[model samples]
Target: MKDGWSVFYITKNAWEEMLRDINNAQSSIYFEQYLFNDLEKGEIGKIFLEALINKAKEGVKVKLLIDSVGSTDFFFSSETVNLEEHGIDLRFHALSRKNILSNIFPNLYRDHRKVLVIDEKIGYIGGVVIGQKMEHWRDTQVRIENDFVPLLKNSFDAIWNSLEKTSARPHQYMNRHLNENAEGFLGNCPREKDKALRKEILSKISRSRKRVWITTPYFVPSRKMVRVIKKAARRNVDVR
Candidate 1:
């Protein structure tokens, strides 16, 4: 572990590690994933669902958030009803009538973050989802054991609390811990049109001296971002 963080390169391995952590959680488990699939087909999803149910039975606070569009299948499945029956505080982000309109023109307004915080002590952040299809993808996950876990938990809480209350804002709830981490800060695509994550990524790429290597499934970046990347490449920054 590097300064209270352990990075896992394989997607399957990350799932296994998270499963272990979920089993060992004492107080709470907060999970937010973009794509959460059905348990029947996805072994990883089944394992995690079982673990969460068991923990909730033991009186642990289990909260889960899934993107409405990405996890549409799972959200409508019996497994989600089972989670609610087991007293799991499961919620879907933006699973609404407006979502039907969004299908025509998807934008950055969706919640696509993958994060998990257990007992407000251990946290996981990565690209892999709870599905069998993700097993073949080359993804990376970081398990963090530090005060930073609370920051992640707070972010999850902010989103959860904002689902019903219209006056409260997630950005204001998360602002205190946004830039507090000494090593690296937890970021999000703010609901109120704040492109904090995008700006940070662009700033890092613009300042890269030797190389900037990135691997992502989505490459539909903004035109300004495309220009910044081209400028970086012109400056002999090995961009890939």
Candidate 2:
């Protein structure tokens, strides 16, 4: 594992760690998510929102990209205005009622990634979202550090540049020092065919010495993969 590399088992703990990182951010914070908003008045949601606002007030470049469908209500609500007022660069993805047909098809192709890249040296990737319900879900996340930060930073830049914005600020965090040697390729669904993470897991299973334990909330394995597991079990390999 890299210097900043860590795993969070549950969503609530993940969010707490995320907020701590956000509070400590010195230069910039870039976030992309599937959903975000306040469900109750002056709730934890508001606290996190205000934290971003305060960071922006302190000259930390705060930019956010949210999926339109997942955050549809928030995108059109008054809350968005407040976020914008605090100098938060907020952009909604592919949302347009004028192009209803195109929007309908792309609804399935969401920005499912939950990413928080702070100071361009620390990056967080996970299944957690900015919502109360997500706290109850069993999710996993990774904190990364190293050369991969620049690649992640470049990806963020590409997405930011592709969006239409009135103003764009430089991410000073990109100049921050980093520890740990990290290198990995970006993986996106629909756009990319091979799921690198999936392949990695399968490879680990194939190389297992003793019992192979597997756990997933959703277990929709392919027929071919099922056959492999059955063959492994028949060969006196203990698999659970």
Candidate 2 error regions (>4 Å):
96-103, 161-182, 191-215, 228-240
Per-residue C-alpha lDDT of model 1 across residues 66-147, encoded as one tens digit per residue: 8877887787788878999999988887644566666544434577789999988999987878878878668889999987
Give Cα distance to truth, residue 195, candidate 1, Å.
1.0
Top-lDDT structure, candidate number: 1
lDDT of each prediction vs. the true structure? 0.80, 0.73
Identify the candidate with maximal TM-score: 1
Residue range 1-240, candidate 2, lDDT tens digits: 556578988888888888998999999999888777664566556667888999999999999888777877677778689989989988876555567776665456666657789999888876777777677688888877766766676666655564554435321112222335434545444433465556766776666667777766678998766876777787777898
Pull out the clashing pairs in model 1: none
- Residues forming the 10-long window of minimal summed lDDT in candidate 1: 170-179
